[model samples]
Target: MGFRDIAMFNDSLLAKKAWRLLKNPKSLFNKVFKARFFPNYTIMEAKHTSGGSHTWNSILHGRDVLLRGCWRIGNGKAISIWQHHWLPRKHPPQVLSPMVDSLADAKVAILIEETSRQWNHEMIDGIFTPMEAKLVKAIQLSRYEAEDSLFWPFTNDGIYTSKSGYRFLKAEDQSEVEEEQRANLLRLNKTTISSHQIAATAKERLAEFALTIPRPQYPRVASTPFQTRWLPPSQGLVKINCDDATFKDQKKSGIGVAIRDENGMVLASMAKHLRQLYTALEIEAMAPSTALTFATQVGFHNGILESDSLVLTTALINNSTYLSTDGLLMEDIRFNASYFNQLLYSHVKREGNKVAHKLVRHALCILDFSVWMEDVLPPIRSAVLDDIVGFS
Candidate 1:
């Protein structure tokens, strides 16, 4: 459906009847207008008016959903330069200035040279602020004479989707909810603390608070001569062990992926450095998706993915649905997993995933993302050799 379709459906049957009446200027709608039978008759236009039906009110409530993801592909005629959402930020091209008179009534066409179908830079520079001028110049003018059209900015293909719309709307609420949750945690100690900047005094108090909880002790296990060793994949499949490490002080996270063949020979290895603030759990949850992306890069069609995060592994397997930000990450993980011919996730002990752990540490100091194949890092090579020898 198009914008007109949405406008029509806002009051579907009544709007259609009104359209027929308006088309016939001599109809009863126009004749009775002097009698104040109806206040306005431009039902086809997308404008806000009071006292509409329930459907129209609902559509008005949802206008922002459609507006936010939309941008105008200008032929420079139908769009208003200062009033419409034609810019990349889903707002008007110009920020409001004290002297608005110069550009207030100007259509976007005023900035375009009609014959050349190119922007008039001098006009734009003279009429717009520096930032607005930059934005105006950056727009690629279309040579074709098609009228201005609404384009979806969220998708690569430039098509509006219900899925994208849902995400766009939900993200606004989700962010506020997340911020509230974080605020509540900081308020526990009656201290105002920023999660991104936890002070040393606050850290000590948090650590002390953590220590106050009683520990559940388990009976000691008898030492066994055998140790858990890294296992290989089945004949046709490769195995990838992935891990994540976060440095809170640095506000950075690292992910490592190690792919091994059926004979336990290292096929490829990848490590990446991410400069973002995430909790340990969020970083851990990110590992499987990062690992799968690496696996696809290495041309692996089928694989067994391993991670030391049981929570992440279970979430990947859909043991329970998550409603948090991790849920969005899990959705992405599932979508990426579908690209593989066959993919399975398994929970491994930290000892079993030692090589990946080492890679995680290796990634921390690296300035850029790196991928190593045949000639693996010395530390990883040592770990592989020990696994091959079945060393305890």
Candidate 2:
């Protein structure tokens, strides 16, 4: 993208105007443009007239540059699930499945739960293949109501900058050059480039890059790190420790919860092997939810819900806002905890959560969710003893 040629540079600048129109339809300039050129449709849908003005022609050129843009899905009301570029993970970035006649012209909102702003999992599974369903479920909806917006993904802020637009042009140009050279020059026994070199060369724009800075001064102070050890709850309360792990190779996730009395004796524990995978933060939030239910089922109305996840512990304790699918998960966690007569969220380091960690690891050997009552499982015997010994 360095030193964009005159033609592409102008196109990049024009693309900025297009972006502004899409970002701020309420702006006077955008409103005027829309009324004149595309009254019934969006700028993207605007057609070329028999004799359009130069300004309109330039905007269309910029709109061509915007073909690479995608929608950062929110309410999904305006986005077509089958037609729009919404699925971030897929190649071509749209639903590959043919539109069902029964649900023709359906908006992306159809796949979402209107009340909760969450994916309709059963509907997703019904509409898509297993792989597609996984991708759809993985997309976290905004916690609060948010409208769909088009954005360029190449830039950090998701706003289309002239620089990013220029980079797209430069990359496209480089690819065409390489293709022509390989087809014509390489076959004639001319100087040839390796496939690896071709890509590196095409993408290489920076000749020299470095940071000019001074090294930091050394600190003489020394400190001791906190050692992690599980703490017992007060009398008449059980403390439940929660942890979770994701297995990418196996395409699954697991959660472990251990409920112990003030004496550090395990009252009940659970290891669940989920059939589906979730993001780390989502799983972390879910772990506490599972723990709450496990303790409640055992008739423990008062307990300390503990975990190594500081994000969740702080969030639950503060009842703060978190922005997406994990936010929804936190809601469920607190909802489950509502069943407890007395509840608390506490955080500890990994060493203190060894029992829960080991129990979740044991989940790999199992097929589905499992729970233990009135006994310590063999896989986590050592971890349970460690906590008990620490308690004493």
Candidate 3:
């Protein structure tokens, strides 16, 4: 709600009545007046007879004496006087003297004290320093004013200054500062890279050597359940499409696969970027496996697996005895064959696999995983379908 609503809700009459009974100001005032008179016969005692000599006397001088006794001793009295004398009354009571006339100004002083306390609390809470909080609040409040004017008159610049203001920075000066920050961050990143470069290089070499070594009779087997229970049941016949990419220099590869039911509705689509010592054959085996895994994950337990690798598909059907080589590649092929048996693996021409080829190209640009599930496929006219399904 707005400030007006807050003011109305916290009606002072309700607050004043509560304070009167709970606080018992008459008893408190008598105690304070007696303490001043009996103990020291102080100036505060003499001034007390004037029915409020100056609003500042009670606020400044009175609070000072009370604080000297003990800072907490008269907190309630000080706050009470602050509220009654200083703050605007819905109906101002009768005033007796000039000192009482100055009560209006006490509101400003009490507000400053309260604001300072709030600022200090924020500083302790680690949001901002006291000075920054004050300055920011001043700036925020200034927006509500009709014209630019000082909130506090003590500062030469008409605004509070503190340690934060030692360097004056305008918004226009930020670009250079930001550029310097970026440069420093990049330098630190480079230093970190250099520190770890030797260890990383050694690790890479070890991985390469491990890949080169052959494992003896460590029969390579594909992960099961994927082949036996993963593929979706197909009606009539399904068209399959696939494509593969090999990065020979980076020794990395990826594959894409898509299967459409007889009515040309997509049953499943998959793409995977593989981390491996790349070869065309590795890309071939990875293509079908990736498709099969994706199909399984999406609950497509009986769909055909498609790939643009005739050799790979043939080997799967022939119990993997036709694998081209020994070593890691042979093991990978054997595992892929076992996986293929679990799914309805099929070979498709590169031309028939244009949709999957496009998907593979798209996969290369993907920095992270993404998926799209359709309640219904968006309609495609004959021209769009022809573009996706290229003739061999």
Q: For each candidate in the order shown, give its overall lDDT on alpha carbons.
A: 0.67, 0.81, 0.41
Tell me the tens digit of each residue's lDDT in model 2 across 110-165: 89998988799999888887877777887766556666667676664466889989
Candidate 3 runs further than 4 Å off: 1-240, 248-251, 275-277, 322-342, 375-384, 387-392
lDDT of 3 by residue, 1-392 (tens): 66744443333222222222222435664456445443443222243445443432333332222211111111122322223321111112112223334453332223222333221233222332454333323211110111111111222222222211211112113445656766887878843233226688889999999999997888779884421111222575444456788766765566665666655556565556655444465466555555655555655554465666776676666654321111123343344434333456666556555567766665555553334342112222232266334321
As for lDDT, the candidate ahead, 1 or 2, is 2
User: Candidate 1: deviation at residue 254, Å?
Assistant: 0.6
State which candidate has the highest lDDT: 2
Cα error, candidate 1, residue 305 (Å): 1.0
RMSD of each: 14.2, 8.8, 29.5
Q: Tell how far residue 33 is off in model 2, in angstroms.
A: 22
TM-score of each: 0.46, 0.58, 0.33
lDDT of 1 by residue, 244-341 (tens): 99888887889988898887788899888987656675677678888888889779979998998887887677755443324445555776788899
**Which candidate tops TM-score?**
2
